[model samples]
Target: MLILKIFVFVTSAIYACIAKNIILIVADDLDVVLDGMTPLSSTRKYIGEQGVTFKNAFAAVPICCPNRGSILTGRYQHNHKIFNNSLEGGCYSQTWRAGYEKNTFATILKNRMNYNTFYAGKYLNQISITISWHQY
Candidate 1:
C-alpha cells in the first residue's frame, strides 16, 4: 500500500542522513519483562533487532501526564514542573502555556534540525482543550 511505501521511504530517508529521526513511543500502564514479553513479537523483531533498547531505562515521573511532558521536553518532571496529571491546578492550560509547547525536544528537532515530526497517540492529561498542537 501507498502508506507502507511512504513509511518505508520516510524512515529510510531519516536513517540515511547524519541527522537521524527520533521516534518515541510511550505506552502506559504496561509492565513486562522484555525477555518474556510475547505479544509485540513483530515490534520486537523489527525495532528491537534493528534499533536500540534500554533495559535499564526508567521514567522520571510515575504520573502519565508528567511523564509525557518529560519525554517531550527532555527534562525531568522536577525541572519541567508538571507535577500532576491534567487537573484544575496543573494541567495544559496552566503549565504548558507557560512556554513548554515551543521548547520541547520535538520543537528543537523540527525547528532546529528541520526534521519532520509526527505524533499519533494520546495527548497529555488535562490540557487537551487548550493546546494549539504543533508539529513537534
Candidate 2:
C-alpha cells in the first residue's frame, strides 16, 4: 500500500540548513544497561565529550509507538494523539485514520521547518520500514 506523505512547509519562508543535525536512534526493548536509561544519557558518558545529554529524559508512555510519537513531537502522546498501529483498526486497514492520529513531531518539524526528514526504523502505524529504503 502507498502511504500518504505530507510535506510540511518551511515556517521561515526559506529552507536553510542552520541547525545542528540531530540523529536520534530509537531502539525498542533495548537493554537500558547496555545503551542508555534515556535516549542519549548513558551513551553520552562516552560521547559526552562530543555532545550534550539528558538524564531526566522520559516519555509520556513506555510503549514504542506512542513513546516515539512523544520523542518526535517533543510532546506527550495525548498531544500527538497517536496511540498505536491499532488506530482505525490499522494505518492502512479497512478504516481511515483521523487527522489527529497522523500528526507527529517529525511530520511537524518537516512541515514547519522544511526539514528533509528521514525515519529509518520501525514506527507504529508506519507504512514502510524496509532497510534498503531507509538506508537510501
List pairs with backbone clashes in candidate 2. Answer: 8-111, 72-105, 73-105
> Which stretches of candidate 2 lie above 4 Å from their native place?
1-17, 33-56, 79-85, 88-97, 129-136
- Backbone clash count for every predicted candidate, in the order shown: 1, 3
Per-model TM-score versus the true fold: 0.65, 0.51
List pairs with backbone clashes in candidate 1.
86-126
Over the stretch 23-77, how does candidate 1's per-residue lDDT look in tens digits? 6778776456554446778877787788866767788887888888788788887
lDDT values for all models: 0.68, 0.53
Alpha-carbon deviation at 37 in model 1, angstroms: 5.0
**Cα error of candidate 1 at position 97, Å:** 2.8
Off by over 4 Å in 1: 1-18, 33-38, 126-136
